[model samples]
Target: MYTNWDDLRLFLAVAREETLSGAGKVLRLDPATVGRRMQRLEAALQATLFAKSPQGYSLTDAGAALLSRAETAERAMRSAIAELPDTTDRLTGQIRIGAPDGSANYLLPQVCAAISDDNPDLDIQIVALPRVFNLSRREADMAIAVSAPTAGRLVVQKITEYHLHLAASEAYLAAHPPIQSASDLKHHRLVGYIPDMIFDRELDYLGDLGITRVPLASNSVSVQINWIRQGGGVGVAHDFSIPAMPGVRRILIDQISLTRAFYLIRHTDDQRNPRLSRFAQALSTGLRAEVARLEGLA
Candidate 1:
């Protein structure tokens, strides 16, 4: 029923701040203007939307009900606005990209630098989180996930695959019993990613072999690697996650290797943006190079 979205915004601001002056400060408007706009909204709604008291203006029953509707309307507007493809020819708009920290750390710099080299006007925003980025709601223009493709209107690429292994500090290895193969691993404390990743349990790489270690776990790959470097028991982290994570040098046995894929992702909405496509290409190329280097498959 709002003829002017501005009125809804003004009402929300006043309701949130509980004072016309506070709302004005946020909206960059004078108190008089804020009050006038809110008053107009209340009059149009034909309800005493707020109670004016010595302390501040407070929402009434009517205002509280309207608040829910107004919030829904605001979210809808924001989603629509967020969906509008950046039509700027110069690639001047900002893009929010979400991905895992490890990928962000190892791969994005070169890709970002490449994007900047091509489109100096482009502004890239990176949001690295442990949680998976949402594509349906546009949480990020793009994402990088560990899992395989899902039933969404998005694009996915098997950007690269990695190998992982059990590793330990030199001192820890020297002090503890030897682990020359999967069978010997059971006898020693080792650095691990906390997955309890036994070769037999997963790849049958250590079939019928029961290996166990500490119960501790870390959400951060780097932290896990650090603990391993400090002689924490056997950890199973990606070779890439391990390089910066701990095991600064080679660790995977010549005969056994753990593997996982890195997928490049983007929402269907972002597919239309030329700059987004460009950025995706750059990231893919960079990922290929990095993966090849890490796996020695180059």
Candidate 2:
């Protein structure tokens, strides 16, 4: 039996947000109400959908099995709504954006919030996956890429350039030997990405530092930042992101720095869609302002 669409919406929100309170905030409903509805839905389906823990709610096997179906339902509902002739001029559809972790975590949230505030009906999903996008497969409606596509039917616009520098916690630097130059990095513990999993060559940061191995490594920028904050080691961080983080400070700024560009990319076929074009313009403007902040120009 099909669960009510309303219940499915709640389930999807909880699944995505990973907490009842989080889902409640998104749905504008009370947590108690959300929990009760989830219980009712579980009873109706005779399935335990979630495994609740102190950390957050995670999908049970049954819930995992149902996720794709739920997503299909969501897409169908959105498609049906999008196809309806709009009586109002507002955009009503979802736009999924794929972006590298640094930009996704540090920059896009405010930009997306401002856009969503203006277009209340729009659903924006930021896939903060630092990997190349397959635009032909519609992996993302839009993306912020490190480099422009050399061969693809994709429209690309250079957004802005930003800088990254070696950084570490104050405590870490005090406890460890002084780093006077790039050569000093070898004497300190370093956090960076796993070599084999470096999806984009531009992300091979350690190579730029002339390091062949990291003392601690993960494929996540957030993890690397946390390690640095915890005095795990020194690592490279974007200038824009480190300012928001009080615990970390840049090191050897004169000796080591990297500059990179962000490109706003979209499928060429989508250029004709008014909603897509409008969002692209907003994103580009917002990114430029953010880059200004990164460059200390804002």
Candidate 3:
């Protein structure tokens, strides 16, 4: 059986994307062309690589075996390319980052903007979701996680420690009974993540306060913050996000405060790539500074 790096590259893309159309978007090819190449590659290897269905193409047992080797080859290719002569000083290509909504909305915009301004050739994509990203599936090049992952072939770096506090809009505070203690929270409408949608224990801010009911709940931190901004209800608000909400103020700061660390996670195999190493260093440094600067204002 004979195959080439190009075929393996296509296989990796399809495996990660789980659809010909998605792989085509990555490779800048039409779906029909991508499908033809996949067929040719499967014939060359004389193995069934994918199981197609209405949902998408899923890797077969043989394809799963090939995936590990293909990833190793991909990393090797990246390393080789990095060693080649430098034609340009600026970094080029697209890097996608997966992060929870809070950091994605309040933090990454300014930080990534500065990086993009400096490196005009680089394209940055931020994927903001409520749950953790699957790095092995290539959902993103890197992810910003609220907590450190305990297992995987991964590298986790503590980006920064940020604070959150029980807060409310001035309007909400004035309209409702004053919250002099955590117990006073019972009389007020509470806003928070849906109980079942709390992806991380660190995110169960209201639960830590011994509050079980959320009158207004949303999975997105941005939505939660907006609810507070519109005088919807009081909830845990990140200090970094408070500066963005002009009327919102932290209440019982000394009594109730939560400090959580943001972690930058990457594949262990990516450590060999110089470009990613440089980008990661820049990102970590930027986040630390931005968090401090924003929290100071809050």
Best by TM-score: 3
C-alpha positional error of residue 25 in candidate 2 after TM-score superposition, expressed in Å: 22
TM-score for predicted model 3 compared with the true structure? 0.93
Q: In model 3, what are the clashing residue pairs, if there are any?
A: none
lDDT of 3 at 195: 97
- The residue ranges of model 1 lying beyond 4 angstroms of the native Cα positions read 1-90, 190-213, 241-247
Q: Which 10 successive residues of model 2 have the least lDDT summed?
A: 77-86
Per-model TM-score, in order, reads 0.63, 0.70, 0.93
Tens-digit per-residue lDDT, 56-107, candidate 2: 9999999988777887786676566545564766666778899988889989
lDDT against true structure, model 2 = 0.84
Whole-model Cα lDDT per candidate? Answer: 0.68, 0.84, 0.91
Task: Give the winner by TM-score: 1 or 3.
Answer: 3
Q: Lowest lDDT 10-mer window, candidate 1?
A: 199-208
- Over all chains combined, what TM-score does candidate 1 have? 0.63
Whose lDDT is higher: candidate 1's or candidate 3's? 3
